[model samples]
Target: MNPFSYHKPTTINEAINLANLTSRFIAGGTNLVDLMKENVVRPKRLIDISGLPLQAIEATANGGLRIGALVSNSELAWHPLIEQGYPLLSQAILAGASAQLRNMATTGGNLLQRTRCQYFYDTGTPCNKREPGSGCPARTGLNRMHAILGASAACVATHPSDMCVALAALEAVIHVQGPRDERQIAFADFHRLPGDAPERDNHLSDDELVVAIELPPPDFAAHCSYLKVRDRASYAFALVSVAAGLKIKGGIIEDARLALGGVAHKPWREATAEQVLKGHAPSEALFTQAARVLLQGARPLSHNGFKVPLAQRAIVRALSEAAFGNTYAGATP
Candidate 1:
């Protein structure tokens, strides 16, 4: 790792004053530290924000929950309010990493986590995301884990956060504070697509710091599920995951929210698919149709054609579980 100066800031103002283009804010150091070791990111200064007053999980004025940026994944997942009101978020966080990592990973850090694309990680390889204009080897190289949605010629990487997928489905809001002002960004708009400039991951400005995540009311708590399929049963990144939240009444879907992970540059919100399921009765056929609608625009790479079908099945199973309140017995690859 490269030599860098470190600063521990107790106040957000102190942290903001210390942040710059060459400075990075560290929370749990789960992702940033790994990238630094890989030489993918080398900051001149590390601003430790863990001591800042951003470690609370409290109720919002609108009967929702506001999770501080520093709240650990394990804490957020097991908190009574989260477990009772937003089980999908809890399940998604638990599906990610291991117990030890979750104990250290923070909510904001998870949202800002970089893609796990092999090309981006290997400094020896040419990757547009790692060094813009160098070219993306994964575009035509080994790309089983590459993206199928919202990808460009410059990059085919997929976002790797299972928690963000659930947040997308829940329609959460992201609060950010910058050197100039504070702003609230819709969760869907927080992460950006890998367009020409694949180097940039999200809409966060260079000087902005995540403050908190504000979740809307827990309407789908009773009928929400997060299903992650991976190479292994545990402690693995998702090959394809589905976060499904449905409000079913008298055998008909009243409202629905669906988001996909491991297939896109950001959390792939299936708004059209949700519309297709809103007024329909839950069935395998209906679920299949919704899945098809969700993956209609998918353009899979050579090795990752399997992700399309895998994501489709996972989506169906997740929706089935959410709508009927029964576990699906199918196996995942």
Candidate 2:
């Protein structure tokens, strides 16, 4: 890895100052360090914000949960309130990385983690995202893990954050400390699409530090779930994943949210699909229609044509199990 200065700030002010001067922020250092070693990202300095008081999970004034950015994946997955109230988030975290990785992956780091695109990782190849106007090798190269939604001609890289997928489904808000002051951005707007600049990943300013994530409390009695399908079970990124929350009463759907991961440049919010479930009874037909709506605009590449059907099935399976507990999840949970 390229040599770089390291600083551990004792206060938020010092942290912000260091962040302003540095190209990188190191929280858990799980993804950052790996990229640094591979020469994919080489920051002149690494500002360690892990020491700051950003590691707390407390109840919001309105009865929701506020999760500090430095909180580890494992801590979040096993937090008493989260496990009981937001099973979808907990389940998504547990399904990601591994037990050891979860212990090291922080909420802020996880959300800001870079994509797993092979061409982007290996800067030797042509990638407009890495080197603008250079050209995209993935367009004609091996790209089984490319994105299906919100992609542009410049790039088609998937956003790889399992927890963020669940957070999107729950309509969580991201809280960050910026140069001006603290700011709260809706989860949907936090992550950006490739558009014309795939290089810019999020709305985070150079001096901003992600503070915490605020999740509105879900009724513990209501059903919710996250389903991830991969080439292998553990320690593998999702080929297609679905996060869903549902409320059903009197044999009619009261509310629902569904977000797709590993298939979109940003968190794929299926608002159209979710609307189909509201005020409707849970049935195979309803689930099928909703799933179809979600995958309507999927544009697949040469090798990844299977992702569309697979993602659609994943959404149907996740919603069906979440809205109505299934034998599979029951046998496991």
Candidate 3:
């Protein structure tokens, strides 16, 4: 580990001031510490923003929620207000990390967590995301976890957060404080594409402090859910996960939204699929048809053809369960 200085600031202004001086933003110390240990991220100073008054979950006048960045994953998952109003988010959070991690991981850190790319973690490899213009090793190397949608030859990493997938489906807003002032970013546009610059992750500037995450009220999030498929059942990232929210009226989908994880560079939303299901009766046939449309442009790698079918089936199964109340049958082949 490298020698580093730590600073705990009590105010947002001071936090941003300290944040601008270094690349470190410490909240729960769960993700950053791990990366720092691996030498993936080395900063001269670590700014501890946990001391600030950023841990509040208050209902907005708009009847939505303003979740403080410092709020632990456990606190958000078990909050009575969140459970009663946004069960999907609660369920997603519970399925993530572990009991101890959920206790220490905070809202800001979770969204900003780095990708699980093996090459990115290894300092010996040439990953453009780890070092600019170094080139992407996963581009031709063992790339089963590489992305399909919104991916460039430069980078193909999939974002790795189930809760953020749900947030993307729900159209949550990200709030941040920079050296200048505060700003709110829409969920869809928060994480940038690797068009050319794979190094820069989110829309966040280098000197910004993520103050909070605001979810625009989901009147029906109580009826939503997140489903993850991994090689293992526990403590593994998603092979293909679907975070879905739907409202059925008279056994037909009235309003539907779906975001997919482990399939694309970003939290891939099945908008074409949702279009197929909306105003239609809840049924397996309809789900499969929409799933087909969503997976139309999937370009799978040699060893990852399974993900194409796996991601497609995940959509079908999640839609059926969320809309028609059906369980997923495992891949037959």
Ten contiguous residues minimizing lDDT sum, candidate 2: 324-333
Candidate 3, residues 1-333: lDDT per residue as tens digits?
Answer: 899998888788887777654558898998899899999989999988888898999998888999999999999999998888887788778777888999999999998998888999999999989898989878778888778777887888888887888788888999988887899999998987788898888888878978889877666653466788887666777778888788888777888888888877788875777798789887778878887887788877655678888877787777767765543322222
C-alpha positional error of residue 263 in candidate 1 after TM-score superposition, expressed in Å:
0.4
Candidate 1 root-mean-square deviation in Å:
1.3
Positional deviation of residue 152's Cα in model 2 after best superposition, in angstroms: 0.8
- Model 2 alpha-carbon miss at residue 104, Å: 0.5
TM-scores of the candidates are: 0.98, 0.96, 0.95
| Candidate 2: stretches off by over 4 Å | 327-333
- The most accurate candidate by TM-score is 1
For residues 1-333, write the lDDT of model 2, one tens digit per residue. Answer: 888888888888788877754469898889998889889887988888889898999999999999999999999999999988898888889888989999999998999998889998896788777788887777678879888777788898998889989899989999999767999999999999988888888999999989999998675236787888888777888888888888888988988899999998878996888999999998878988999999888888888889998887777788788878861211111
Candidates ranked, most accurate by TM-score first: 1, 2, 3
Candidate 2: C-alpha RMSD after superposition = 2.1
Candidate with the larger TM-score of 1 and 3: 1
Candidate 1 off by > 4 Å:
327-332
